[model samples]
Target: MSDLSGSERRKLEKLLGMGSGYVLNFSDRTFGDFFDEYRVEIDNEQYKTGGTSKANRMRTFWTVANNHVLGRVIEGLIEYANEEQCFGDSNPSLVTNCQNIAKRLLSDQPVAELDALTAISDDYDFEIVANHVREAIDKNQPEAALDRLHTFVNKLVRITCERYNIEITVDKPLNSVFGEYVKKLREDGHLESAMTDRILRTSISVLEAFNDVRNNKSLAHDNPILNYEESLLIFNHVAASIRFIKKLEASIKTKSATALDKTKDTKNDDFIPF
Candidate 1:
């Protein structure tokens, strides 16, 4: 042990403490034999007095320490096994799994937020767009993810147009869809709250900037590769927008339904159709 390098001594100490039992038995002796030739030569005459009792006390201390150390080592080994592939850059599943585990352990946020955003209207188109975005993020393809966000905005606009019975061609630009849908939402009084309107307007500006980035700098066009920061920014913006829009749309539909129910009641004359 004295002759061994510092790291090697530490490794041996760890290995020695990893076994079970309160005393060094046949198994422990067998392990020590691996370094038999390298054991430091002892000058026994210098400390012969009371050496046997000291050695016995040292052995007792080590036995207790070994039991404690082995328990911790087992725990560490299990933890490492669970996260072995998590830091591997190539394994998306491992990364996601590790994130989920850590998130579960550390967070008190609503579990619903971790779930995929639910569409307030027909979900087929929304799901398709969301899946594309999810895959792009999982694969670390930030540019593709940003492009998917742009695509999602287009889909959302189209869905809004359909909801309002507004005619729009498939070839219409994103700006046109945004302008028309927002105009209709405003005119119909569905977007009544000043704060809500501000959020929507601001989000539209973000969407426009996102569109430009996708077209001019993201992988959607001939440009530089998207870095983690840029991609994460786009992802957060896109995800926030999707969650807000879906919740808002769902609330409006609920309001509309409630209003319609009131209209059917002859006693309620002030019911307004949405």
Candidate 2:
């Protein structure tokens, strides 16, 4: 169910023109069409009754919809209001208010971390895997996404290992590759904090345990899946680690570039007359 507070929902309802018997410049047909675009069935029998208003349908939807669907529907309504100028000159702050609501909604989601993972790489394979993970997250089904998340982490660590020219074989496991990568980072002096080192070291075990999760407790096999709460906890932990690693890689790249520029400047200065 959506996490939106009653106050938040009321604010959205008023701002989106759903406080009346209508929604943002939409007739019943257009309203249905809009939700259909998002693959949402707003005409569900459970949300309908004799002579029900669109406002009532939306209120019921908000109560029962998952956060991800709620976010999408809210965003769509906001966009529609903007495009149609539904608020007119009555409230100059309506657009901003709607945007703030959307931001608060997203703040509770793992979207930022997912965006970070995609930002770190643009490879098609990476995007495909990330999208699969995102779909599950959006549906509030982290347990179902565990296998894809494992694949994504394995791919990410493999890419990081490749950047440092670490040898990896097809049979190498995720934790093994990650451990080697962490070792190389420490050897090269990229690891500057004792705490960071400890965290990464601990993550090696986490990923090691994750392998059993994928094989035994995820969609990778027919075994019973992990529960939703534990699955979300694992996802958050891995996502945080990925965020830290991205920052580390960016720092390393910037330093390498700066050092290379200095070496070039030194070479130019040392060049004497032929």
Q: Mark the 10 consecutive residues where model 1 has the least summed lDDT.
A: 34-43
lDDT of 1 by residue, 1-274 (tens): 0122344323323332322321122233432342232221112333233243323322332332222222332233234434543223335554344334333322322122323333435678777876776655444344556776677767766776788877789776776676677777788888769887877777767766776787887767778757756776667666676676677777999999998887778555666677
- Which pairs of residues collide in model 1? none
- Ten residues in sequence with the least summed lDDT for candidate 2: 111-120
Estimate candidate 1's alpha-carbon lDDT, on a 0 to 1 scale. 0.52
lDDT of 1 at 67: 27
Over the stretch 1-274, how does candidate 2's per-residue lDDT look in tens digits? Answer: 7788877877887787775688777888898898887666788787775336788888888877767667777877887877887878656676677677776665568444755545247888888988888778776678998999998998889888898898889998899899999899999999989998999999999999999999999999999999977998998888889988999999999999999999999999999989
Give model 2's TM-score versus the native structure.
0.70
Best by lDDT: 2
Best by TM-score: 2
lDDT of 1 at 258: 94
